[model samples]
Target: MDRRAFLTAKKSKQPASVKPLPLEGRTSTGLAVYTGAWTKSEITHLLKRTMFGARIDDINYFAAKTMGEAVDELLNPVAALPNPPLKDYDGVTGAATPDNDVANGATWINSVNNDGTIQSRRRASFKKWWMGCLLQQDRSIREKMTLFWHNHFATETVDVSNANLLYKHANLLRTKALGNFKQLVRDITLDPAMLVYLNGRSNTATAPDENYARELQELFTLGKENNPNYTEADVKAAAKILTGWRVDTTVNTFPSYFTSSRHDATTKTFSSFYNNTTVTGRTGTTAGDLELDDLLNMIFAKNVEVSRFMAKKLYRFFVHYDIDAAADANVIEPLALILRTNNWDIKPALTTLFKSEHFFDVLNRGAMIKSPIDHAVALCREWEVVFPTAAAEYADTYGMWNYIMSVAANNQQSIGDPPNVAGWPAYYQVPQYYELWVNTDTLPKRNQFSDLMIGNGYTRNGKKIVIDAVAFTKKLSNPGDPNELINELFEILFQIPLSQQVKDQLKKDFLLTGQDSDYYWTNAWNIYIASPVTANYNVVNTRLRGLFKYCMNLAEYQLA
Candidate 1:
C-alpha cells in the first residue's frame, strides 16, 4: 500500500518498500524517490533530524499525516520570538568628547558605559535565555535557522560589547531567520551590533576597512573560487560602498544610521570578474541605500555561486559534514538548482530537501556527530530536565543561565560567544570538521555534565525531580512488557543500529536482573503501576535509571 493509505489504516500492520538510498561513506545522490508506508523508525528519524528531540505524541501525529503535511508543518513556522525585552542603553545623550586622545570615540563610549562585570553578566543571561529557546523550541526552524545564520555570519558578543545591541542583532536574525537571504545580508550589513563588532562603524571613504566587506563575499556568499565572480578589487569597492554607517546604541530608536557625508561618493569600478561593472556615485541621503542595492543586485544576479554556497552550508548543517563525490553529484548540485529556481526563497528548497528520499537514506541516518547543543538539548528533553527561570536570571551563584551557559561553553560550543568571527571551528574547519567538537578537553567535560544530570538531577532554586525514569517508563504504551520497554527506550534514545545480542544483553542486565524470562521486569513494573509507593518506585526507578544512563553514555547517543 501507499505511504498515506497505510498511515491512515494502521501502523502496526504497515508494510513498506523502503530500500536504503544508494549512499556510502555518508553521502548520496540528490534525486527524489517514491516513498512507501511510513514506520515508527521513519518517524523517529524525521523528528530527530528536524526538531531538537522527538516526543512520542508528536511522532505519532506525523506518522498519521501525508508527506506534504509533515513537510509543511516544519517549513512554515508559526510561533512568536522570545521576548527578552532588553533595555536600549543610551550612550549619545551626554557623550564624552574626543579629548585629543579619544580619536576612536566609539571604543571610548563603549568602555565608559559598559562595565566589564556588567557586560559579562548580561552575556551569560543571554546565553541561558537562548538555551531555553533551543530547548522549548516553541517555534521550530526559527531558532534552528537563527543559529545557522549566527554561525554563517558569526559575531562575538565580546567584540560587540553592548548587550542591548547584541540583543537587537539576535532579534534581527530570529525575525529574518527563514526570510529572504538577500535581504538578510542587507540588514546584517547595517545592524548596529555588527557595525560596532566588525568595525563597520569605523569604516570610511578616507580609510576603508575590508573586514566586513571581505567576509560578506568570502563567508556569506561566493565561497572561494567562483570564476568570473569576485576579486580583491571587488572587496575594496564593496568596502567603500559600505562606509559611513554608524551605531548609536544610546538611543532606543534608530540606533543605526547612515552618515551621508562620511560615505564615499567616488565611482567604484569592478574588474572583468564582474563583467567590468561600474557603480555610479551619489551625493545624497539615499547614497548608502542605493549603493547597497546596487551591490546586492550585482551579487545576487550571479545565482550559481551564491546558490551553491548556501546549499552546501545548509546540507552540511542538517546532514553530513563532509561531502563526498556522490553527494556533490546527487545532493549539492540539485539542491542548488532548487534555490536558484525559487528566487532564493528558502522554504521551498528546504521543504524539497527534508521530504526527499535522500534525507531518509539509511546510511545517512546518524552519520553526523552531534554538536554540543544537539547533545545537551536532546538529552535534557528525553530526561525531562527542568532548570530555574531565565526571564531575568540574576548573575549571582547558581543562576540558570550560569548552568546552561557553562554546560555548553565547557563542551566547546559557547552559545552567545562563539570562539571568533569565523564562528566555531567545527562548522568551517576542514577534514576534521565535526571531529573538532570532541577532544580530550571536551569529552571529559561532556561525560561529567552527563553524569551530573543523570545522577543527581539539576536541583537549584528549590527545584528537583529531574529524570524520573520509573515514572517515564510507566507513561509508555507498554511499560509492563520488558521487551517493549527496552525497544521503546532504545528507539527514543539511541540513533545507531544495534544487534539482537546487544538488545538481549540490555534486557538481561537492566530489566530482567539476569533472568532469561521477561516476567521479572513485567512483575516489577506492574507492581509499581498498581501500588505507586516509594518501595515500588525505587525498585523500578533504580533499574530504569541505570539503563537510561547507560544508553545515553554510549557512543551511539553522541549522534542525532
Candidate 2:
C-alpha cells in the first residue's frame, strides 16, 4: 500500500512485440470460428467490444455457453443495475415561473456558466455517476449501447447545465437504447436538455429556428456524408412543424411544454427529397407531439435512408471503421436490410453482426483503437482494481471523476463534454477514425495513466487505490503455471495475437527468472499461496505488476 512498494517493484527488462493474429481459422477459436465453436479469444473479443473490458468470471461463464445464448444474454440488459440517482441538491432556489416566454432560457445561461456553485458540483457528480456505472454496471452490453447512443445523440453538460435534465436525458437513452429508433428521436427532440442544446427552445412559428431540425436530419437521422435526401427546405419545414415547444425553467424541474399560441397552425410541406411529405400541424396541447410523430413517420416510413444511416453508424461504432467494398456488400449493406426489416430495432442488427462469422475474424480482433474511457475502464476492470466507488466510501470519487474526465479530455474524448454536436471525432471522421484517439498528444497521457494505476496506484485526498496484482493473478485458473499465466494474461489484457516465443520469453524473463523448470514458478506460487506474507508472494506480485505495466505500455494494448 505504501508508495515505496511501487517504486521498489521489479521492472520489465525488455520490451516484446506481439503481432496481431491474421484472419485465418487456424485454431478452433481463431478466425472463421462458427457460432458453436466459441474460443477463449473470441469470448474475450465479445466482452471487449460489449462490456468495455471482460471480467474473469464473465469470460469463463460465457465461454461455456453457445454463441446464441451469449448474444441473447448481452441483448437483454440486467434489470438489477439501476441508474444512480442524481441525489444532488444545491441550496439554490429554482428558476422563476414560466410565462410562455424565454425567461427560463436566460436563467439556464447563468447557471451553466457558474463555477463556484452547487449546480456545477451537481453536474460533476452526475458525470461521476455514469463513469462509476461504467466501472460497476452489469455486463449486459447495455451500457456500451448507451454510450453509443450518447455519442449518436450527443449532448454536453456545458450547454444542458441542469443535472436533473441531464439525468433525465441520459436515462431516456438507457431505457430505450436497444428499443425502437423512432421513439428515441421523438423523446430526445422534446427533451428539455436537448431542446436547449440545439436551440429548440428558441424555435417559434413566428421566427422558427432550424438548429434542432437541421441536426435531426443531418447528424441524427440521415448523415451528411454523401447524402442529399434532406434539403434546407426540409429543415425549415421541420422547424415550423416543431415550433411552440418551450422549456418551463420555473419550479424544480424545467419540463418541456407545448404552446399552442406560438404554434404554426398551417400545414407544413417537405421537399421532394422527403417524398413530398406533409405534416398537417394542429393547435391543441398535443400539437407538438402529434406533429413530431408525423415528421418521424415521414422520415422513417416514407424514406428508407434513416434505417441504413443508423445501421451504418452503429456498425462503425461497434465494428471496424473502414467498411471496404467487400465489407460494404457483405456487412454494412446486409446489416441495413436487417435494420429495415426489423422495424429499426437495434437488437436484430447487433445480434446478427456480433454472432456472424465476420465478427470473429482474427484480424478484426485489434482493428479499432480504444477510446480514453474504454482504455481506462478496461485497465480497471481487468486489473480488478477496487474503486473508491460512486459513493466515495473509501476514496475521493469527486476527485476520481475529475481525474477520469481530465484523462478523457486530454485524449480528445471527454465523456459528458463532447466538443460539439458531432460527438467525438473518433466515432466519426475519415481515414483516421478511431486512430485519432491516440496520436502525439494523447498516447503519452494514456501511458502515464496506466503507469500510475499500476506503479504508484491512483491516490486522491491521501487515500490510495491500487490493483492488488497478487490477488488478481491468484484468481487465475492456474497461477502457479508460468506459461498459463503468460497466455491467460494475454487473453485478459490484450486482444492481439501473442506469439508463443514471446510468451515463453515473458515467462522466462519475468515469471521464471530465466529458469527452464516449470516447478520453479509452481513452487514459488505455492509458497505465496500458503503464506502470502512470505517473500515469495512479494516476488510474485512485483513480477506480475512489472509485466502488466510493460504490457499496458505496449502498442497492442491501445487497441480493443
Estimate every model's Cα lDDT from 0 to 1.
0.73, 0.75
For model 1, what is the error of residue 381's alpha carbon versus the real structure, in angstroms, after optimal superposition?
1.3
lDDT of 1 by residue, 1-560 (tens): 01222222221211234322355534333546426457666777777777777666676688788866876887678876775623212323333431232221112222224445555545655666677677777525677788888998888978887766777788899898878888899999999888988899999989999999888888888887676568899999999999888987555443789898899999999778677888988878999999989988888877888999998899888877777777766678788988888888787778877877667766566667778887777667666665544434322223543565667787988877788877888887887888788878877777777877768866665665266676567657798888888787777776566667998998999888788999998999888889989999888888887788777778777777
For model 2, residues 49-136, the per-residue Cα lDDT tens digits are 9887988988999988888789889999866655454333333445232212213112232233223355565677677677777777
How high is the lDDT of residue 111 in model 2? 34
Q: Residue 495 in model 1: shift from native, Å?
A: 2.1
Q: Model 2 — which ten-residue stretch has the worst lDDT?
A: 24-33
Model 2 misplaced regions, further than 4 Å: 1-33, 85-116, 389-395
Q: Output the TM-score of candidate 1.
A: 0.88
lDDT of 1: 0.73
TM-score versus the correct structure, for each prediction: 0.88, 0.87
